[model samples]
Target chain A: MKLTTIAFDADDTLWHNERFFTLTQDRFADLLSAYTERDHLDERLLSAEKRNIGHYGYGIKGFVLSMVETAIEVTEEKVPAHVIREILDMGRDMLRHPIELLPHARDAVVAMAKSHHRVVLVTKGDLLDQERKLSESSLRDHFDAVEIVSEKTPDIYRRIFAEHGDGSERSMMVGNSMKSDVLPAIEAGAWGVHVPFDLAWALEHAEAPEGHDRFRVLDNLGQLAELVGEIG
Target chain B: MKLTTIAFDADDTLWHNERFFTLTQDRFADLLSAYTERDHLDERLLSAEKRNIGHYGYGIKGFVLSMVETAIEVTEEKVPAHVIREILDMGRDMLRHPIELLPHARDAVVAMAKSHHRVVLVTKGDLLDQERKLSESSLRDHFDAVEIVSEKTPDIYRRIFAEHGDGSERSMMVGNSMKSDVLPAIEAGAWGVHVPFDLAWALEHAEAPEGHDRFRVLDNLGQLAELVGEIG
Candidate 1:
C-alpha cells in the first residue's frame, strides 16, 4: 500500500529526550545517597513512575513528582525539604532545557514533509512541555500536523491515522519505543518502523515483532527516507 | 454570519472544576497554618501559580508543584517530608476524582450535538487529566472534536475554528472565564458567550466586555441552546 501519511514519534525519536530524564535521575540518586543505595533508589523511582503513570502520565512534571515521592518513600518520610526543592529545580531545568535534535532527525522529517505523504508528529507527554519542545526544535514547520496525545495505544493510532490520513493501511509510524511507537501502530494495521535509540525507558521495553511482515528496524534515522523509498 | 460551530470551555464552564481547586487550597492552608497566616499563604500560592504558569502551564499538576514550591518557601525550606507527601497525595486525588457535570452542561451539549452545528470542547490544561475527565463525564460522544491546548489565544482560536468548523466568524465559544474562554475567542472574530461560575481563579479574572456586539453573558448553560437559536 502507498504510504499517504508518515507519523514520527517525538521525544527520543526526534530529539534528545530520555538523556535529560537520565541526567535528572542521576542527580536524584546523588541527592538521596545518604538515605539509600543508588540501585535501590533507582528501583523505587522506576516503581513510582510505573505506578503513577496512570495518574501523572508522561513528562518532566510527572518525572519530578515521582522523584519526590521516591525520595520520601526511601527516606521513610524524612527526606529533607531542601532535597525536594532541588528535585523541583531539576524538573524546572529540564522543562527549560534546550531542544537537541537527534542525528538525521531533521533530514528525515524534511524528506517526509517534501514527499507526497502527510507528515505528522505523534507524541505523548505533558501538552505544554511537548509544545514548548516543538516550538524550540526548529522542526515544527516541517510537520503538517502535531498530535500531543495522552498515550500511544492501538486505538489511538487507528484514530490518528484515520483523522490525519487515508487510513492505518496507508500510513506508517516510526519511533524508538517498540511498546509505544512501533508495536501499537503495527497492531493498528500500519507500517511500524523502529529506529532504535541509544537509551530506552524501562517501562517502554517490549519484545520486538521480528517476524511481522510490516515490522522493520533501522540502525538510525539516517536510513529512514531511503527505506521509505524502497517500500514505495 | 451563520453559526456552524459552538466550542465550549471544559474546566469551570462545563464541569465543577475550580471548586475542587478551592477545596485543595483550603487543605493546603490548613497544612501550613503553623508556618504562616492563611491569607499570606494564599497570596504566596497565587503568586507562585502566576510566576510558574510559563514554566508549568495550567493544570492540577502545575498547581501541586506551585504548592510544593510555596510550602518550601513559606516554611523556609523546612516544611517537612510529610507535608510534601501530603501535597503529592492531594495531586493524585485531584487526578483520580470523578467527573462532576455543571448545571445544564449535559443538556446544553446534547442540544448542540442535535443542532446543525459542530460542537467542540476547547480546553487548556493537562492533556491526560482533561481526557480522563471527558471519558468519565459520559459527554464524550456529544462533541464533534476536543482541543486540549496549552493556552487559548486569538491565533489558536482562529486555527481551531478553521480546522473544526467553517471559520471564526461563524463560530461561538461559551465558557466561565472571561479571560480564557471569552476574550480570545471574540478577538479571533467569533461570538463569545460567558456563563459565569461562582468561583474564579485569580489568573482568570477579567472585566466583562459589555458593549461588544458578539459578546453575550448567560447566567448558566441552561440558556445556551436558546441563545444559539437566537444568534442563528
Candidate 2:
C-alpha cells in the first residue's frame, strides 16, 4: 500500500481516552451495586447505549444520559438523585482529564508529518471535548487539517479523504476501533491501521475486516511510522 | 426568487436556545461573584470563549469550559473547586433542559418540508446535543438532511448545498445568526432569510449583506412559508 496522507484517530489512538470511560463505567457499576450486579449494570448500560445511539449519537454527554437512563431502568425508576449526579460528575471528570500521549504517539505522527504525508487528525466525538483534547495534546501544529466529525462511516471517510487527504488510493486511517476507525476507512478504499487499546468501549467493538489487503494490526503505536515507511 | 430547497438553522432560529445560554451565563457570573463584577466576568468569559473557539470549538461543553477557565483567571487560579463544580452543573442543567420551540418554528420548517423543497437542518454544534435537541423537538422527519457541522463558512455552505440542497441559485437559508446561518449561505450564492432572535449571541453578530438581491429579513418564523410561497 502506497499512502500519501495519513489520518489519525484522536481518542485511544492518540492518547488515553477510552480507558477513562472504562474507569468511569466501573465507578458507575459500583454506585449501582445495591440495585444490580456489576455485570448486569454493564450489560444494561451497553444495551441502553446501543438503543440510544440513533437518538443521542455519540459522546460523553450521551453516555452520561444513557447511564442515567440505565440507572433509572435498573432500579425501576428509583435510582437516587445523588447517583445520577455522581454519573454526571464522572462525565465531567472525563472531559476535564488531561491528555496523556500514548507511548510513541507524538513521535509517530510527528515523523509522518515531517515526511511528505499530509497528516490529518480525524477524530469523532463531542467537538469541543475533542478539540480541547487536541489542543492539550500539543499535536495541533502537526496536522494539515483537523476534523471532529459526528461519525466515522464510509461516506464520511470518502468525503474527508476527497476534501482533506489524497483520496482513498493514497490515504490511510490509523486508529484503535475496527468498527469506526478501520472498517470505514478500508470501505472507503483507504488503508486501515489498527493499534488496539487495552480498554475499548463495548459499543465500538467489531471484528476487523479480515482478508482486506490494506488492513494492518499493530500491537502498539510505536510501530506506526515504521509501518508507514514500509508501506511507502 | 425561486427556491427549490430551504435550510433552517437550529438553536435560536428554531427554538429558545440562546436565552438559556444567557441564563446560564448569568448564573456563571453569580458563581464567580467573589472574584469579579458580573459585567467584567461576562466580558472575560466572552474573551475566553473567543480565544478558545479554535481550541474548544462550539457548543455547551466549550461554553462550560470557557466559564471554568474564566473563573480560574478572574480568581487568579484561586477559584474554589466548588465554583468550578457549579459551572459544570450549569452545563448539566442545560443538557437536561426541555426543548422549547421558538415562535412558528414548526410551521416554517414543516411547510417547507411538506412542499417540494428538500428542507434541511444546517445547524452547528455538538453532534450528540444537536441530535438530542432535534429528537426532542419532534421535527426529526421534516428535514431531508441534518448537518451538525463545526463551522459554517461560504465554502461549507457551497459544498452542502451542492450535495443536499439545490445549488446556490435555487437554495435558501433561514436562521437568526447573520454570521453563521445567513451570511455564509448568501456568500455561497443562496438566498438568506434572517429571522432575528432577541438574544443574538455576541460571537454570531455580523452585518447582513444589505442590497444583496436574495437577502430577506422577516419579522418572525411565522412569515417563512408565506415568504417562500411568494418567492415561488
Candidate 3:
C-alpha cells in the first residue's frame, strides 16, 4: 500500500478528546446524583443522544443538550435550575479545556510528512472549537489541509480523498473510530489504519473490518510511523 | 461597483433564523418566569450569550446553554431542574422547527445568478445544522459555493472572495449584518450590501459605515435584485 497522502482524525486519534467527554459525563451524572443512579443516568443519556443525533449531530454542544434533556427525563421535571447551570458550566469548561496531544501523535505525523504528498486532518465537530483546537495542537503547520466536516461518511470520504489526495490507490486514513475514520475510508477504496483509544466514545465503536485487504490495526499511535514506513 | 461574484448570508438574510431563536427565547423566559421577570431574563440571557460567544461561538446550542446558565444565575441556584429540562425542550423544538424563507431571499439569489460569475452562501453556525438548513431551504442549487465558516473575518473574506469569486475587487457580499456580512467584506475590498433585518441578533448589530464608497443599504432583501443589477 503505497500511500501518497495520510489523513488523521483529530479528536481521539490525534489528541485526548474522549477523555474530556467522559470526565464531563461523570460530572453530569454526579450533578444529577439526587435524581437518579449514576449508571441509570449514563444509560438514559446515551439513549437520548442516540435518539437525538439526527437532530443535534455530534460534538460537545449536542452532548450537553442531551444531558439537559436527560436530566429532565430522569428527574421527572423536578431538577433544580442550579443543577442545569452546573451542566452548562460543565460544557463551557470542556470547550475551554486545552488540547492535549496524545502520545506519539506529533512524531507520527512529522514522520509521515516526509513521504506523503499531503498530510491532512479531517475532523467533524463544531467549526470554531475544532479550528481553535487545531491551532492549539501546534501541529497545524505539518498538515497540507484541514477539513472541518459535518459528518464522516463514505460519500464525504470519497469527495475529500479525491480533492485532497492523489486518490484511493495512494491515500490512507489513520484514526481511532472504526465507524468514522476507518470503515468509511476503506469503503472509499483507500487504506484504513485503526489506532485504538482507551476511552473511545460508545457511539464510535464498531467491529473492525477484519478481512478488508487495506485495513490494519495498531495498538497506539506510536506504531503509526513504522506502519507508514512499511506501507510507503 | 461592478461585481463578478455575489454572496449572501444564510441565517436571517436568506431565511427566518433569528425568528426561531426569538421564539425559543420567549419560551425560555416563560419557562423561568417564577425565577425572574421576562424582561430581566431576556436581558440576562442575551448578556450570557454575548459573554459565552467567545467560548461557544454561535448557534442554537450556545443560546440554549446560555439560557440554562441564566436560569441558574437568576434563581441563585434554586431554579427547578424541571425548568432546566423545559429550556432544553425549547432548544430541541427550535432545532426541529421548519425553515421559513425570508421574503425575496430566493428571487434575489435567482436574480444574482444571472449577472454574477458565482453566487455563494456564506453562513457561520453548526456545520450539520447549517447544511440541513441549506438543503431544507431548497436554495442549495442557487449557490455556486457554500462557505460554512467558523467566523467571518476580513482575512476569511479575502481568501474566499479570491478563491470562489474573481477577487475582492470584483466580489460583492450582501447580507443582513453590518458586523459580520457587510463590514468584513468591505474591509476585504469587496462591495458590501446591507439588507436590514428587524430581528437581527444584537451581537450582529454595528454602526453603518455611513460614507464607505462601496457600502449600500436596502430596506429589505426585496430590493436586492434591483440593487445588484444597478451595482453590476
Pick by lDDT: which candidate is best?
1
Runs of candidate 2 exceeding 4 Å displacement? B1-122, B128-174, B178-194, B197-232
TM-score of each: 0.99, 0.63, 0.94
Computed on alpha carbons, the lDDT of every model, listed in order, comes to 0.94, 0.83, 0.86
Q: Where in model 3 is the C-alpha error above 4 Å?
A: B114-116
Per residue, candidate 1 scores C-alpha lDDT tens digits across B73-145 of 9999989999999999999999988888998999999999998689999998899999999999999999999
- Model 1 DockQ, alpha carbons vs. true complex: 0.86
Q: Scoring only the second chain, what is candidate 3's TM-score?
A: 0.95
At residue B215, give the lDDT of candidate 3. Answer: 97
lDDT of 3 by residue, B50-76 (tens): 899988887878887888888888888
Residue A138 lDDT, candidate 3, scale 0-100: 94
TM-score for chain A, candidates 1 onward in order = 0.98, 0.96, 0.97
Which candidate should be chosen as best, given TM-score against the real structure? 1
Candidate with the larger TM-score of 2 and 3: 3
DockQ list for all candidates = 0.86, 0.15, 0.71
**CA displacement after TM-score superposition, residue B6 of candidate 1 (Å):** 0.4
- The digit string of per-residue lDDT tens for model 1 on A64-102 reads 899999999999999889999999999999999999999
RMSD of 1: 0.8
Indicate the worst ten consecutive residues by lDDT in candidate 1 chain B.
B11-20
Clashing pairs in 2: none
Worst 10 residues of 2 chain B by lDDT: B79-88
